[model samples]
Target chain A: MLNVGKIEEGFVLDHIKAGKSLSIYHHLQLDKLDCTVAIIKNARSSKMERKDIIKVECDVNMLNLDILGFIDHTITVNVIKDGKIVEKKQLSLPKEIKNVIRCKNPRCITSIEQGLPHIFVLTDPQKEVYRCKYCEEKCRQRW
Target chain B: MRHLMSPLDFTTRELEQLFDLANDMEQHRERYAHICEGKKLATCFYEPSTRTRLSFEAAMLNLGGQVLGFSDASSSSAAKGESVSDTIRVISCYADICAMRHPKEGAPMVAAGRSSIPVINAGDGGHQHPTQTLTDLLTIRSLKGRLSDLTIGLCGDLKFGRTVHSLIHALVRYENIRFLFISPEELRMPSYMTEMLREKGIAYEEVIRLEDCIDSLDLLYMTRVQRERFFNEEDYVRLKDFYLLDKEKLSLAKDDMLILHPLPRVNEISVEVDDDPRAVYFRQAQYGVYIRMALICTLLGLTGEEGGNIC
Candidate 1:
């Protein structure tokens, strides 16, 4: 068993698809943090066969969970306090997002403005399609 | 009522009412002449489009309203890095209603979000051109005396024609609207559009040659092969000559088949076809004015029936 010590206070990102933990770690900029962080890759799971996990010993204040949700909807965040799991946060796709995803269409005004905050609205929730609010360009998950 | 960003913004019933109003405006032009006597229209054209801008200006003028604003962005505060929001906010203070045309797909949408007055999208980048769609709808309604259960052929550049796409979007809601897309392989209609048609259970067929099925069409909608939409000049040259509608092409079409074009056409439509009774692009352009008048009136809260109270 590849068991890592539990965090006294922080968050554990679970159910990350295999090989995606590194991207999430970089996205959250966990490597630059002063706190202890561990990534368990290809961990066995009954539900997903194999998954990756991320654990941190300090709470990330600047972290945006919506980006994580937008990247992977199945990811779950578990908060730990006093060496015990306090709350389990589930992620769902956001209806509207600002400054997270960028519109890729070259002709879009957003592409030329550079200073304008990229905004997207979920037009089709069933299809997980988000269209740029300014350009009507479909935004795809980078990962 | 606040914005005309998309054709879907107006309901079918509202569209019928608008058409009725436009019909009345056409029949008795002088009756609604002073409807917008004191009002002002700001044409905030970030891009230069002669036909659309003129149509809007003419519509407001025909209603006896004043028109203002720049035809090009470089000539306005937009050249100094002012945001669309700021521009529209400023215009809203000066005008009763505004018509904006920009090169960006949703630039008008952003303006519509901030503007206090009604914002009509004149033509937003290859996106939705609601007014043009309205013009097309009015044309079809007037010419055919019907809006449903017809075979409409959309010829030439189906891929990048905003007019064709907008017309299809409006027509799909009608009872029986079957689309016949006639284009070469490289410029065929996008799959996203076809998928929408399939999802709606609408009948449609794609043909490489227009003459193959021209005889069965009730209306033939032609589009210019935009040089701007092409990546290379060579490709543009190759496809520019792809669909030439000369006398020979018209012979295949039915005698009563109406030919329409969102104009400023280059060479896709032969000049000889212009004199033919079937060519109604000029009438189509004239209808653009009436539709815009109806739209401007409706958006400004005038029901078009309160002729005496307009003053």
Candidate 2:
């Protein structure tokens, strides 16, 4: 059992896609953090065959909605008071988000030479297709 | 209002409004310059759709708006395994609206449900291409003055042509628009579209021969027999010849008859038809910009001169 030092405070991201710890770490920019952080990849998961885990020991206030939408996983944020979980929080889909991930359409206006921000709107929940406001293209697969 | 994911969703009036606005934008592009100023429009294309994507950027730019987002998926956080919902939720914060294209069916609809701002469906898989339908409508209106009472022959891969599928659905709104469906037996238009035509009381007929109805058609819409649809080499080679629209074949047609194609064409139509003065595919591509311009203005609620640029 690898000892992931107990956090006096902060969060524990659970059920990450296997081999995605480093990606998540880079996404969150954990290396630039002012708090102690620990990551474990290829960890056994009850819900998943294998998972990755990350523990952040700081009062970071940010929403990782991109992760929630990118993969099928769970994240748990806990506020620690004297080594006990004072508050436990799970990641939920945000109604809206900003500048987290890039659109995958190569011919999309965002892919042009101009300084345009690539965007998509969630239309269908069951299929997860996004519509481009400019092109009116509908795509179900996430890029 | 959340998204234009399908032509099925737009009412006749709403679709016409898009056309009307497109007409105005085409005649006077500079008039709508400030419609999207200070607002961000995001283009999220999951596939390689250069023509479709650039049309959107042109629409936004002509509207005096700024655009952003990624053309390639690998460059985005999605490669690192980001969820679609999370991605849009984040993008919604930065942009006032979005355009998306995906290789999978119904992906944009997923983003729209989670998004607060407007979502526009660019194209998805081999499914709906509503914007292309809009372009067709604008072209017909400009060239023929109306969408009704015309004999339109749809030639090529009916089963796999997304534009053809969408065009047929759109034509249902017009009165007395007869259809001469031309395609190989294996590539026949889907039964659902036929059922839809029947339910809507639109008249149509399917024929394997394009020349049989060439002289009778007021418009001939051509598409490539998508080679990707055939499993065997023998089937593709056999069916490929059955749909070619050459100028010699056009000589048997009416001079007033207009020919159209949702371009990026293969060998379906002979290049000789380009000088026939009836080929309207290139003009059709330009209308794409006009139609999209009108759509952006309407969707963004920039109807007023101030919103669309007064000075």
Candidate 3:
């Protein structure tokens, strides 16, 4: 059995779909931060058959929960302080996300414009649909 | 500060006010002759749309404003790889207001975000052409005497007809507007549009032939159905004539029914039908100029008493 140490501060992202820990790690830009991160892939779970987990050692306020929520709201965010669970954070869909995903529509202005920010606006929260701000093309969630 | 990115950018009440201004401008052109005398309009058409560009230029010129800018991207700074944002910021310094038409969807929107002057989306790929919608609205209101409680038939290439979709959306905001969609099976209005109508409980019907529903229409909006939109030549050949509007088809329509086409038309509307009193497509083009004049005045905050306080 592989064991990981508890973080003194920061987030313990739990119940991420298996194999998605690496994606979450890169999306959260944890690698760019000057802190330790432990990634546990395919961890056995009672709720999910197998899931990925990420433990970050940094300030709790450093992480952008909106990106986390937009990526996978089903994942649990456990905030830790002094190596103790402080708060269980909940994730909700963001109204707008910028530069996270590129508009795939070839006819979209963002495709040809240099240095244009790829913006997606949440049009349908019930169906979790995000449309490109420029072309109104629905984002096909790949991840 | 306000830019027209979509037809819905203006509410129904605002549209009514705008139509009133357009009607007034149409009635008394001399009053609005020199309202924009000192203002300059920059027409930055990245794609060549001679009809739209000319109409905008005519509107500004009619209002006594100067017109300038390149008609195509090749002649403009865009050929030098200038971004829409950068170009609009520079045009802001030159013109009091700007009209932009680009081949790519949402290019005007990108420009609007960075522009110091108001940006009118002349047309953006197949995404939107708000001024066209405004023109349609103004024409229906002026000729029909009202915009509501009427049966409108939209014919040809509904699947890809951005104007049809925009018109449908704009009209639904009015009360008791029924739609008759006429097109071949392959080019029927998309399910999303029909679904929207259904959700709103607005009445609509889908038909394959224009002749079948001509007499029942109060207004008929026609668009060309290109052969390339069909899957095979056989289907295109079989279905092409059914959608064509000829004198025979016009005979079946009501005497007062208005026929409107966003022009530069092909065989979808027979040239023989042009002389028919019911065919108002030419008059619709005239209305385009009037509506654009109203739009420029409104956007520049020049629509006050006697053409408002012009800066």
Worst 10 residues of 2 chain B by lDDT: B302-311
- After TM-score superposition, the amount by which residue B123's alpha carbon in candidate 1 deviates from its true location, in angstroms, is 1.4
Q: What's the TM for chain B in candidate 3?
A: 0.95
Ranking by DockQ: 3, 1, 2
TM-score of 1: 0.92
| Best lDDT among the predictions, by candidate number | 3
TM-score per model over all chains: 0.92, 0.66, 0.94
Q: Per-residue alpha-carbon lDDT of model 1 for B1-311, expressed as tens digits?
A: 47999898889999999999999999999988998989999999998998999999999999999999899989999899888888888999999999999988888888888889999999888888899999999999988999998899999999988889889999998998888999999989999899999999999999999889899999999999998888899988988879988899899888888999999888889999999999999999999999999999889987568643565
| Chain A TM-score relative to the true structure, per candidate | 0.88, 0.76, 0.96
* 1 or 2, greater by lDDT: 1
Q: Which clashing pairs does model 1 show?
A: none
Model 2 agreement with the true structure over B157-236: per-residue lDDT tens digits:
88878889889878877888999898878889989679778878888999988778898999999987766666788988
Off by over 4 Å in 2: A1-143, B228-234, B304-311
Give per-residue lDDT, candidate 2, residue B94: 93
Stretches of candidate 3 off by over 4 Å are B226-242
Among incorrect, acceptable, medium and high, the docking class of model 3 is high
* Residue ranges of candidate 1 with Cα displaced over 4 Å: A8-10, A26-37, A56-65, A79-88, B307-311
Tell me the tens digit of each residue's lDDT in model 3 across B67-143. Answer: 99989999999999999999999999999999999988999999999999999999998899999999999999999
